[model samples]
Every structure is written in C-alpha cells, then in structure tokens.
Target chain A: MSRSVTANLKTKYLVMTKKVIFIILALYTFSSWSYAGGGWPVPKGGFYFKLSEWWLISDRHYTDAGQIDPNITSGIFNTSIYTEYGLTNRLGLVVYFPFLSRAYVNNVVSGTTGDLLIAGDAINTIGDTDIGLKYSLTPQGSIKTAVTLTLGLPLGNSSGGSQQNLQTGDGEFNQMLSFDAGTSFSTKRVTFYTNVMMGVNNRTNDFSDEFRYGLEFGAGFLDRKIWIVGRLTGVESFKNGATAAQVNSTSIFANNSEYTSYGAELSYYLTSKIGFNVGYASAFRGELIFANPSYTVGVFLDFTK
Target chain B: MNIFSRAILWAIVWSFLSCIGDDIIDDRVDPVLRITNAIDTMEINTNYTFEALFLNHVGKEEVITLEWNTSDPDLMRIDPDGNATALAVGVVRIGVKGIAPSGEAVQDEVPCVIGNSTVNNLKERKAIVKTTSSYLLEGDAVLQEMEGGFLKLSLAENYKASTALPGLYVYLTNNPNTTAGAYEIGAVSVFSGAHDYELPSEVKLTDYDYLLYYCKPFNVKVGDGKFED
Candidate 1:
C-alpha cells in the first residue's frame, strides 16, 4: 500500500455521519493491539512473527457514572507473542499467546504509627491466549478487506492472587468476529493510509459481551522507509455482567472491563526484513478497568516479504 | 530516527513526567475529630469538659488547639478551655474543633441536657467489647442515647486493634457472621487509644446485639463484641 489512492472509493455505497460515528465508538473499546499491517494479508506460505510488551499502572478508575475516582493502585505487565501463517492467498491462521502476565498493587501505610494499614499482594501467571482464522476478500479497486474469527482460551491464572480482584484472567471462554477495511493513497514523498475494524464479542462467563472497534491513520514517507500511525480504539459492554456488589466478593473477576483509548505507533525499518514497532495507549474514559495509559514495544520478523 | 519515533518518544517521556499522581492515592481515612467522653445528658449547673479522645490524619497533636463552642450560648456556655456550664433549662450542643499544623480541621458535637428528667430520654452505659475472633479488639465502648437526638459510640482509653488489617468497618449488627442486617457505622477511622462515632437517631441499639469490626472489601469478619450493660 505504498501508493496514494482515494480512500473514499466506497462513498457512493456508504455514508459517514456524526450519529453513525458516535454509535460505532460508543459500542466498542480497545483491548488488544497486535499484528498491525498496511491493508495487506500475509502472503501465501508466508510466516510473520511478532513479540511485544505492554505495561499498565492505575491508581484510579472511572465509576459507573463515568466519573473518575480513586481506587486500588493496580499494576499489570504483559509480554505477548503473535504468529500468522498464510495457508492460501486468501486464507491465514493466527495465534496469540501472552506468556508472562503479572499483577500487583500498592500498600496503604499508616501515617500515625509508620505501619502498614493495608496489605498488598503480587501475582504472576500466563494470560489468556487466542487463536483465529483470517480470510481475505478479493480486492475491489483499491479497497482491501478481511474477516477474522477468533477464540479466546482461558489458559491464564484467574484465581492465583490473594484477593479476588487481583486475578490475571477472567476464567471464561470467549468468541470474537471482526471485519477490517483499509485504503491507501500516495503523494510525491509520502503515502497515506487508513484502516478500521469492527467486531463483536461473546463470553461464556457472566462477564458481559461487547462491541469492539478500531480506527488507524498513518503515512509512509521517503519511499516507504518510515510509517507513522495514530490509532483510536473502543469497547462497550452489554451491561449484563455481574457487578462486584452483586457477586460474593470472593468470586468477582474482570466481568465488564471496558475502555475508550487512543494512541500513537511508530515503525522504523532498520532493514527490509526487520523493523521496530513501539506504541503507547491510554484509556481516557472507561468502566471496570484501569483508567491509565499502557506502553508497548515490539520487534517483528517478516521473512516472506 | 523516523519523525514518528521521535514524536512517540517525546509523548512517552511527557506522559511519565506528568504521571506524578502515580504514587499519590487517596486511600487514607479523612481527618476526623472523635470525642469519647460525650454524654447524652448533663444535670443543670453541672460542669462538663469537652475533649477529643482520638484525632485522625494528624501526625503531631501537641501543636493543634482544641477549641469548644456551643449551639445555644444562652442555654450553655463553653469556656476557652472547653468547659461547659449549663445555663437555662433548655437543650444545647457542645462543639469541639481542632486544627492541625497541616491546616486540616476535624470537628464534632454532642448534646448536653439542661432540663428536667421528664423530657430527657438520655441514657449512658459502659459495655466491654471483647474480640470474638483472633484479631485484637479490646476496649470499653460508651453507648449513649442523647435526650435531644442521636446516639454516641466511643472506645475506651485502653483500646487497640491489629494494625495489619485493611478496610475495617464498624457496624451495629445482629448477626456477626454476616453484615446482612446491620447499621453501618462507617469505616473504622481509629485503631488505638480512644475514638468516638456519632450515629443517627434512626438506628436503635436495642435492634442489634453485637458490635462488629469487619473488613468490607475482603468480606471477612475480623471480630465482634456483644453489647452488655
């Protein structure tokens, strides 16, 4: 997608409105960011490998009423790996595994006696993994599209921490289906591209299912030597999940984690086959989730290209 | 050395620099002024000294001045030293305020009787609250129902609880095993020495038998003490 082309190729078939945009953003949030590309599927028989790390620490959370309020000082770290293999020109298999996930929080100390007033615990375990199949559709003019179906496996520790809220995983199987669309256009020195995804999630636990959405816009400069991107992602729960007050304190997990986040990503190619990807994202508005930013850095290997 | 990487690096660095609230958490209980010696009624012409047994959120208590005032100065007079002298035959409130060197203030008030015994529903009793569980909770709680309105709960001079527990709450409950039917007295603001909490008149002591100390977030019952005359 190094050439600049009209992104409004489907304007005659679709309309973009404030009402429609708000409806889409309000229904979904960003939970994961992986295997980003320039509207291109993995070539047939091609293999792509990516490794990334994300860090989050939040001392506050958004309330049910959408107000920011102080809460436990929670910290989480995730190191994830993702792989995609192109089985056919239009078909691919993807796997995501977060091998190392950690959770902890700060302690409250008594100012009077210099003693600990509240205790804190640290827990480390594997995070939930996902496997999916992505099928690319035949391109229409300059527009590229793909659909993916993913399955979330409860392979992480959901009951490891001393407190019920400290668990790393939600202990529930989930299914998600997504549609992705992207287009690219080029100027004399830079090529501009835009990508968007919409998805639906289903869960087995009482945790709420959700609608998910993402939009990314970027540019490739100096003969595709550098790609700079900005991203917006969101998720909205169905409001049907069990709340902490509704469940026994010992049994409550991350039932309805939701957030609307925006971030920036940079990809620098040191060589044609190897590049560095770094990103930082934060939840400006959220419910039942950490209300702070997260950081990510990854290295990619694209041998087939 | 792409412009995007440079821009992202600056953004990340700026975000870290602005995350100063990263370490600041508002988990501590608010500064409170608890007067353990509060009484429901005082005989006319009786002198009562208003004092705070527990002061929370203040590191140094020696520099803070405890000042006293009255709701009805005509019915009761409070001296600069917090001594109250009953005046006319009417109800009045004795208030105490203490401002720490840190500029934080904690204040409280209790009613004093200045009338005949007929309209006075005021009664005060001492109950020994022993720990029901393994946690350390030993103290004398002064239970008083004011003639004017409301009730007061206080810890004795020699009172203490385990310092390791978090999110501890005090409740007037019939069942200590569960907070199912309990009048929430709010979180425990003080753990040692003496402290006092004022309850609304809606909660009757006769409705519950046990005074419970519970961990609300963890849903664990630390200990309990039954009210006995």
Candidate 2:
C-alpha cells in the first residue's frame, strides 16, 4: 500500500472511535459535496449518470453548543441528476442538478384548543447546481490521485414562506477545491477499495468558508455485482463570516453550521451497466443543523463498465 | 419488480410521505383574571370604576362577566359593575373573579388604601431572563414605564445568547408557553451585551407578565422571564 492510503486507513480507524459532530447544511448541496468521486477520474470516453432522490425530515436540531433542541417539524426533498463524462485521458466533467426541490414546515396546532397557531407552509423550486472538472494526477499508479474544482451556483429560493425562514439554498455562490487519493486491493474473494478526501470551500455573501474531509470504504461481493459502502464525512466552519446579529436577513439556516456524519450504502447491479443504490446517513454530533437521518434512493447507468 | 422499478416506487413513496403534517403543541396555560386599571390608593369619598381582563387557557383575552367584591364592604363598597366608593380611611382588598371558557375558575386581588389621593399602581418590574432550552441565553431585563405612557425594555450588559439560534425573536406575553397571542417586540439582533427596545404607548409596563424569547420560524420557546411581583 502507498503511504497516503496507509495513512488514510489509520486516520479512518481513529475517527471511528471518536464522536462525529457538526451541521449538515443546505438541502441538496452538502449531501453530495462529500460524495463526489474517488481518486480515479472517469476513463477516456467514459460516462456515468445517476437519478436520485434525497430527503430529510427533522423535528429537532443540534444547538450551537452541540446539544439537541426541539424545533417544529420540517422536511426537504430533492430529486436530482448527477453525471460525469470523461473529456480526455485525464480530464472529466461533472454535473449535479436538482430539478425538483421541496421544503416544508408542519403546521403548529394548539393541543388544548385544536386551533392552528401557525399555518404550515411549503415551497417548490429548483435547488442549487454544481459543475466541476476533475483531473487525474496519476493515471497509471498503484495509488491513484485526483483533484477537483467545483463551482456552486445559487439557483434555489433562499428566503421562502411568510416568515422567510424556509430555504432551499444558502443564496451564496461558492467554489470548492478538493483532492482525493485511493487504492484498491483484493483479499481472496472480496474486492475492496478505500479513498480519502479533503477540500476547502470558499463561499461568498458573508457565509463562512468551510473545510471538508471524508473517508469511504467499499467492498464488492457476489462476483463484484453487489457492493457495500461505508462513509464518514465532516465539515468544519471557519466562523469568519457575519453572524446573525450582524446580518439583516432573518434566515433560519444561519452561517457557521458544522457536523460530522456517518453513512452506509448498498448498491446492486442488475446488469453490467445498470444498477440501483440506497443509502442512509445521520450525524452523531452537530451544531446548528438538523438532528435526523437522511435517506437516498437512486438508479445509475454506468457506460464506463 | 425490477430494481429500477423498485427504486422508482421508493421515490414515489417518499414524495407521498413528504406531505405536510400537523404538529400539536401543549400550549395550555392557567386562566387568569387581572385588573388592568388598578390603583394603589383611593381618596375618601372618591368614586372609581375598575376594569378587569380575563385571559383564557391559551392566553387569548376574552370578554367575560367578572364578579367584583371588597374585603371590607363597610369601608369600601364595590358593585357588580366594578364601581367602587371609599366611605372611610382604611385599607381593603379589591377582588375580581371569573370563569374561563374551559370552565376553570380564576380570580385576582389587589390591596387598596384610602388615602389623600388616588395613585396609579405603576412601578418598574425586573426579571432575570434564562433559557429553557439547551441554547445559551441569559440576561437581566427591566421593564419600566416612561413618559407619554411608553414602556422601555432594557437588557443588562451581562446578556448573552447563542447567535446561531436562527430567527430568534423577543415578545411581551402573559403566557410563556407559547407566542400565539403574544405582542411581538421584534426580531432579536443584539445577541450579547446591553440593548433596549421601546414599546409603543399602547403597551403598558404591567400589560405582560413575562418577557418571551421565541424562534419565530420554528415556533418554539427559547427562553422567558417572569416579572418579579
């Protein structure tokens, strides 16, 4: 194993013992940010596309101090398309677009009077989109490495509902630079791959810049037709941006959200090129973020296979 | 079903499940009968008409028939219409009782002394605001009557709150359990240190029994301060 892959394995083991905490931000944005790709860029003339739905319904959230506090039940759903196509021998193009996004808050009714204290509201719109270019740093090596530069486009409703607290986006354009390194190995029958990622997201509109990292491990079974993947991702805020007291907007998804989460996914290939996947993720610790599990279901077409 | 068809079915089910639902909250508060226009003292042979406000279980004010009485009817007699006459120089307790819409009995009483002149019972009230949730919120707050019938609510310098708490708002309310009928002061912009909010002339210093801190969007109570009697 290469030094970087070995180091990543050690780091992953250490983080597993420690508690994960921080905020999972936006609707569809951060959910896909850490799961973009591994170290290998798509091969020349290769293409991979996925149609997925992701949702989160929460009745509480972690306070700034990492303590859970009750909140009105709220939910967000995003139906998105993610695609990656190889442009050259070492370059690839990536796109993630959520064409349908819905965010809603439950109606608050008085238990004693059976009267509506606050009416529920919902908004339907397109969520933010991300376009990126990934370049392979080492096309021929035991340990593969790649770098990706993703541009975030603010396209969804930042302020929705009567109180302007329901949001589908952060309303700020951001640029993220990330690096990935991974290696694959086979143990008798099981094919295993491990990857590590690190990134820095520079955000505009007074939103805090964030440092992102993750570790992903996948093992294939049944003649490499079924794969089980486990992931650990985290985002740490720089906290240099404007606070709620300094900002004029009464946005409930305020800045400086941080969280560390763990997720598991099961992927089954019905054929050589067609597959389906289901995933579940939740935070063990968080601040200024919802305290609930998120679910994802998707079908993919892999021309690269 | 095929894997693709199953995935599609799951997505459809998730969409159906995402529909809005109702969240019932326990907002029941004790019904209260309060004398809105109260006096600390009344002059001998003076006539004054007292008014009382009845708040229901949810803290919404409702018009209800209140029975008025005086402790020493010989010294000061109050009629059923709340009309009072001080006949002698003495101290007596004026009481008003009412039943709420939920059939809960409530009453309030105040001590009145027959003196040289009738004095309005207006005084500054203070309370220590503390968080009822896990969020960091605490401070000293004072509500005082100003000239022109305005009320000035001032927070002490030691006040500090979690800036990450989004949509944090302040209000003056009789019930601290909910903000359904509370008078919204405004969104809270000052998270720490001292700040003051000027309430309109219509809001009296004694109008609200508690200062409320709520998250407007989440519709949850964050903190509250009960006025020290």
Candidate 3:
C-alpha cells in the first residue's frame, strides 16, 4: 500500500527469488542425506534416476537493510533430472540439471488509480547444472559413511527477462565436497534413520564461497511402501560478494547470504524400486535471502541387483 | 524417536520461526522540491527565473522536468520551467509539481506578493543542480550565466550532504557519473548551506551536461548536479 512497503515487497517477491533458484535447487537436488541416493554407494552396476520439480514464492526477504515486509509475490518453477550410476561397490557417478526453469512476477496495481504501477513478467530457461562423484567408505556396516565432490555449471540465464529481477540462475561456477554419516533403528512397523553432513564450497567470479551442513531423519510407512523424512540445512557464506542497495538493479545473490531451513517430505513407492517424493521447506531465519516457503515433488527409479 | 517427541520437536522448530523478521524496506521515498535562491516576493512588471529544486526517490537529488502554476493567475503567472512574471500588486501562491515515471507525484508551494517595481535587474538564465547517486547527496544549486562568459553556481540552503565521507571533488563533465571528460572544479568545501562556484569562460555551460561530485581515491560518486539553460 505504501511506497516502502511496495518496494520491499517487489524486491522480495521478484528480485530475491531470481538468483535464489540455484541454492533452492541445490538443496533439493544434492543435499539429501537420510532420504538421499542410497547414502552408501550402490552395488557395482547398480543405478538410480530421479526427476524433481520445485516451486518457490516469496513476498518477504532478509536484505542488507534487514528483514522486509510482504508486498510482492514472486515465484519460480523448475524441473530437473538427477541420475547416479555405480562404477564399483564403493564409487558412483552423479549428474543433475534443471532443464526447465521459469521465473515470474505478478502485476502490482496502484490503490488510487487501479492502474498497474509495476507490470508482471515471466522468463523461462535452463537452470544451472551440476555433475559429481560419490564414494562409500565401508563395504558393509550398521553405520554408513560416504563423501561427495561436485562441480557447478553456469548453464542458466543470470541476465534474463525484461528486468534484471527476472533471472533464473546465479551466474557463477562453484565446487563443493562433503562428508556424510548415517544410521538406522527399526521397530517392526517403521525404520527410523538419522544422517549428518558437512561440506565446503568453492566459488569464483567475485562470489563468496560457503560452508554447508544438513541433518535429517527418515522412517518407512505403510509396510515399507512409503518413506517420510524431515531435514534441517544451514548455509554460511564468506561475506565477500558485492552488495547494491537499489531493489531492482544490484545483485544480492553474490552477497553474504545465510540461512537455516527446515523441511518435511513424503515418498510413496508404487512398486519396488519406483517412487515419488513430495515436500515443503521454509527458511526460519536468513540474511540476504528470501524469507518464504518452497514446495517440491520428485519421481524416481531405483535399480538394485 | 517416538511420535510424541517428534511432535514436540516440530513445535519447537515452528516456535523458533518467530525470530524471523518480515519487514522489507522502510518506505517508498517521495521526490522533494526546494527553492535555492530563497525569494519570497517580487515587484510588478518585473521578470524572474524561479529555481525550483528536486530530488528523486533514492534520496539522491536528480534533474527532472517540472510544471509551474500560480494560485491567482491574474496577479502573477509562471511558465513551465518556473519562470515567473508579476502582473498585479496582489499576494499569490506559486507552486511546482512533477510526476515520476512510475506515477509517483511531488509538489511544493511558496508565498509571494507583486508590489511596485524595486530596481532594474539584468535578465539571466537559471538551471537547477541535482545529485547523481543515492545516499543523501541532495540540494538544488542555481547556475546563473553572467553577462560575461563567467558563471556562478550556488548551493541552496536546503542542500543535504552525505555524512563523514571524504575526498569529495566536483567537476563539470560530458557524462553524469564519470569524470573522464570533466573540467576539474576542486574539492567540495561545503556540504549544505549557500555556497558559490565561479566557472571559467573558456568552456561554456553547453560544454557538458553534468556537475558531478566524486571521491577521487575511491572513485565513489558522492553527489552532483547538471548544468541546464
């Protein structure tokens, strides 16, 4: 209604989500532990394939000027494929790409004139892609441990749409390596498991690198036909990126963005080795990031022999 | 974990979300209008070029088009760029208004009387000065071309400056933000209040489009105004 409110809302809904797609996709694609790509590496000649779609919308943000109120509603929709194939009993190859990604903003009307003050916009393109390798540390154990290394490709459009606020990707290349450990306990009807992971991110092109961590719990439902999981993730950036105050122009994606988020997911297996995961995630606290919720759905195929 | 403990954990997580602040930006700033020369009244049959100041939404003063009007057109009349001519010996209100590209509006008014002629005055052209970037570099300086080739640039009393910023230098340039084509004018001695800058006749006001204040060492833009006819 007011100008400041409107400006803040516009940036939150439109601008914050522009580059945020990369991080959101990162979490949904690679940061899985408890409900991940079979934590310990698959057997030799085994494979796992997954397809995920994510939708994110926000009317609020944590900016350089602190938290902003809701005034604008911005959204992003992306669908990507994640695939893994075991090279040996202890090693595997991974590939991830959000081939179809779309970013958009809703129109804003003036209260006085009922006329459009800010017109709506939409842009569709490919999102950033990733490729990696995973290795198992133990052949067989009650407690499993593994490690992963991945490289990011700047395949998405960083400068797309009518305004700069309509971008679908972060324009930077990065690499990350992480350590993960998990364990499970069963009680006849359900098997509950916990996993923990920590990693270091390396970046280039004036963007800051980061340290990432995740902890999660998962259990089986309906005679092991379904799986339900809850996860918590943290991202701490090395505050060395650029920051500009103008809501429409400056790129906050390169700035020091930090967040702690929580999520819940349900995976229904229609048949052995075939399933779908549906989930919702939200950042309870963050800086230089959107303060909103994201929903995700994925269908996967598992080949175990 | 048991169902009761899992439920408790989720409730605790949801409660911690209260710490998340939701305010985005403070306000949509209103463009401002200031009169640098500070004149209240004029005599009949006399002509004066009114200098109305303006600042954009970012708190940075910038040049903009303005339309002027008078409450009593019979007593006094104002042109589009704020040029006023006293017609009758009566008090009236002169106002300036501007609308932004986004349809945001700003306006200001002042009181003046048209009485008897006081003195013979020279007819001079005037242009309003504006800051280039954001962060509180705002003021309206009036640049009046003298009878000779020399010109006088004066900062209005309402001018505001960025605090604690050093190495601020002023220049006349063909560009708005850069000093590549600038004619060095020297450091900014004052941030606010009325101040004057004497310009050389070699380069006419038409030589460039902007009067810029930049930090020499940091290459940061402090503020600036444009030279207009």
Off by over 4 Å in 2: A1-35, A252-254, B1-13
Which run of 10 residues does model 3 chain B get worst, by summed lDDT? Answer: B18-27
For model 2, how many clashes? 8
Give a tens-digit lDDT track for model 1, residues A164-221.
5455566778888878777666567766667788888888766778788888777666
Give a tens-digit lDDT track for model 1, residues B1-229.
Answer: 9543554454344323332122222223345564545666766777777666333442112435778899999888988877878777877788888885457777778777676432334266566777654446788887777766678888888988744334567888644554544678987757788889998898654445568887565444567777763
Better of 1 and 3 by lDDT: 1
Per-candidate count of clashing residue pairs (backbone under 3 Å): 8, 8, 12
Instruction: State the local distance difference test value for candidate 2.
Output: 0.76
DockQ score, prediction 2: 0.62
- Looking at chain B only, the TM-scores across the models are 0.46, 0.91, 0.43
> What residue runs in model 1 are displaced by over 4 Å at the alpha carbon?
A1-40, A111-113, A139-141, A249-254, B1-229
Question: What is candidate 2's lDDT per residue for B136-181, written digit by digit as tens?
Answer: 8899999988878788999999999878766789999987888888
Inter-residue clash pairs, candidate 1: A4-A185, A4-A186, A5-A185, A28-A234, A28-A235, A29-A234, A29-A235, A30-A234
Question: Per-residue lDDT for B229 in model 3?
Answer: 37
RMSD of 1: 12.6
Clashing pairs in 2: A21-A260, A21-A285, A22-A258, A22-A259, A22-A285, A22-A286, A23-A258, A23-A259
